[model samples]
Target: MCACPAQKLCTCSASSLKKTSNHRKQKRLFRKAFFFLQRLTRGNQTDTFRGLLLKSTCSFMKNSIFSLILLFSAALTGFAQDTIVLNNGDVLSGEILEQTASHVYFKSAAFGSISINPRDIAEIRFTQDQLGEITVPKDAIAKNEAKPPNLPASKKPEKAAAKPPQKDTSKKTKKKKQWSGQAGLAIALRNKTTSNLSGVYKDEKYETYRLYGNLNWKGERNSLRWDWTYRYSEDEYKIRDDFFNITQKYNRSFKNKNLYATAKTLYQRDYNRRIENEYLQTAELGIKWFGKDSRVKLSTSAGGGYHIYDRLDSSRSNKTSVSLPKFIFDENFSWKILSAQELEIIQKYTHLGNLDDYHLVFSFGVQNKLVRELFLRVEYKIDKDTEVFYDDKGYYDKALLTSLVYKF
Candidate 1:
């Protein structure tokens, strides 16, 4: 507990100061009178001064001495009071008059009564039990204003430390899809005829239905793809053609370049042109002319491999099985004609054993997006084989397909 009032003290007015000054003067006068009275009565001669005067003077002197002792005690008590330490390294010896959430009211001999922000106070110490009680705890001082231990209260406080920046967790990177696949079913009209300038033989026209699908999986450095095709043809009376083909390819791309390496395997079966079974394997190096999603894309590749085929013939010379070295060339291109439309072309040329014996296939297609993950496609294909196995001269085949495709 402390004696300084919680409220501002108005006792420092001019009148109050005048009263204190009068008290000091009175103390001095009393000291002189007490000495004077002592000397006068030193011999214990009461009779000389008269009993009434001597008694009154002795009584007055006793009261004055007691008042002087009280004043001296008050002065000494004021010197011994409470202490307060500030955050700015300032030390204060004073009485804590009042404490509030926002301010600390203090009374100091040097600064007098003043209000201080609680944030600026570092510590409070009470030297006497009689000092006033504080409802607010010493820890109520704001944490932001706390000082370092190495610095003394008399030195200036150091600048505040800078705060570290926060991380941005709201945004994240998304991964790209690694696998893509498509399946399609189509109906086609096809024509195959060996006769050209002269109508020495008849031409064959048939309606065909085909189903095809492809699966592709790609990674940072390599990729794999598989393609499948199946077709069946019928005339007015019977099934004229049945065909199926499947191919698988693996590719590895060079680092920081558009070049790539590829290996492929193929299996095919067709009964119309007397082809019962065929197998092929190839290795090639290729380059991309544009990015995967570019508006226009073109690529070409050349490779060599061996071809094996089994043919059916009732004639005198029946080639049931044969394997021959082959040379191959492939071209692929695509163009996006509109926001939802695209055109594609693909051609492959294969030379089997002899120079005159070769196979060629060319296809052109247009795809229109019909809806999400769905497309309508139309394609025309031309196929020719220079080697003839049956009565038919070099085989020539043509087909037009309309298909519905779904992708995921």
Candidate 2:
């Protein structure tokens, strides 16, 4: 009678409610299983599920053990066993590729490769299994050994053998001084036979002779040079031209070696030009634009000095003596075409207080070495002076000479 009242209040049975709860539980379990399978097979759709899983497992295991593998390798190989201790209390670890007298080459993982001066290194330590064995000093071994019984006074250790004195091999070598000289002579003779106006045969003889000498002494920083030339000519048994010149020069070089100070003196006499005698003294400063070591050398100088001109007829005529201040400019050029051949050019200008009264001289030459310290030279020279006497004759004089030179 009590169940009749409860059934009238409830519409579903207990068994149906239990079945519906079971269905919901099954659906939740299926969903969880599907999601778990999807997660395992993601990102590996082209491969079989078993292969993908195997690969992933292997990758994880390899990553987890990589550092352990590296550690074992380093321990076995001694990666940084080549150690260098520096004098400044620093230590460097690297693989030493080579050691030289002055430097060490090392390779480091961090720095790639580098050079180290031996002076900066205090010690080098190598692994026990390296190519070479480290040497231990006797003193170090003695310190590590046990003490021995004291020796008698007569058995004391002998003094170490004394080392022989070493030679001083660092001094600079000195260069030798150079000396050169040249001498030349030339002669010309002409004979003319003709009939005179009186129907008489006459003979005319002309003669010319020239002599030249030059000496040069070159040292490390100084040079001395001298040159002399003499010429005598007779035309038809009458003296036509007679002249001589002597010149001396001393040069002192400065610290630069390319710059120098020079003192020069000259004495000259000319009968054809009416210059009985002439004297000149000058101090000059010069620069060598191209040095002696080069294939070509050029030099220039400028100076001022006093000049004296004495004429042969000044004493007999009303002409006064010529004394004037003089200015001079000089240029010298030399070129070595080969080890045994050379070319030279020299030019000089002397101004006697006026532009119109000046003298110019130019010389050019070629020299070929024939033997050791001996050479052959051929030269051409021109001399022009505004103050010289010039009439129907030319205003300038020209000369060509071939000479042999010797050097010491």
Candidate 3:
């Protein structure tokens, strides 16, 4: 500040003054360059060096912007690519060209264009834009097409315009009334020989014959059943045991099909048991624990009814008639051990209120098929009664029977 160069200038050393002068010159050069560029662009003459540089710069910028736009468009299209997933865990990115009831046409960058069965594709993913106008057929997306080798000619797919409405033919076949029956016969012979003064004389000769039959008519919700059995035996040409029984039953099933109501009537005669003639009428409710087609079946019934019995008193040499209120319980069980063999067990209990007596009958049998409709049956039965009479030898009676049966 000893001697200022000017009013607003400050005195400095020689090196500082040289640096300030260099800075001033740089500023002047910058200002001159900026002005020269501005004047060159504002002029109308484009053939000069400045005009050519400006044109080149503008072209470069335009090319860079177009390149960016192209890259963005490519990225968007790649993100929107469709996908096809196959059943065998194959994934393919593609565009769907067309779809029909049985096949799909697709185009892919890697695999080119190809036609494939819709059955082979497990899933498909489409772009949002493609989904709006997709034309895939409903059946094509729903059901798998049958394979070519085993496919029927009638099932071949036609053109989309010729497609027909699908028809459902899956209704079950209606059942009709069915009838089944069985018949059987049995014969037995016995002989007694005594070795006395007369050598090997036939003392007793007797024969037994038995006939049995069963019939059933089955409908949708009801069934009718009939059973008949007859037995005759002679000892020394004199009738020894004569018995017959006939039963008729009508069964009506409930909505559950396993529960039912039954009306039954029975007529019977047994000379050995001293029952001359008996009649029973009853109404019962029954339940089946298993289906009819099951290998094992069990059914139980309980009812009360009136029974009229004509009894023969051998000691008194007279016949008596009695009417009683009876309570009855029945259980029937059958098991099919094989296709051709079956086992059956039947049990019945009867309680007589008037006589204050109870009766039980049980039968066990095995049936084996011998031919198409013929079977061999072996059965053992036991009958027991609480009532004792003069001719009632024991409290229980037992019998064994073998018969040949025919079924229809």
Best by TM-score: 1
Clashing pairs in 2: none
Against the true structure, what is each candidate's TM-score?
A: 0.56, 0.51, 0.52
Q: Write the per-residue lDDT of candidate 2 for residues 7-84, one digit (tens) a residue.
A: 855645776788999999999999999999998878676577779899999999998799789888787546646887
The order of the candidates by lDDT, greatest first, is 1, 3, 2
Residue 223, model 2, lDDT? 92
The deviation in Å at residue 259 for candidate 1 is 0.5
- Total clashing residue pairs per candidate? 6, 0, 0
lDDT score of model 2? 0.68
Writing each residue's lDDT as its tens digit, candidate 3 over 205-256 gives: 4556899999999988989999999987654435366779999999999999
What is the alpha-carbon lDDT of model 1 when measured against the actual structure? 0.74
Estimate the Cα RMSD of every predicted model relative to the unseen true structure.
Answer: 20.4, 21.0, 18.5
The sequence of per-residue lDDT tens digits that candidate 1 reaches over residues 212-245 is: 9999999998999999999886644453567899
- How many Å off is the CA of 144 in candidate 1? 13
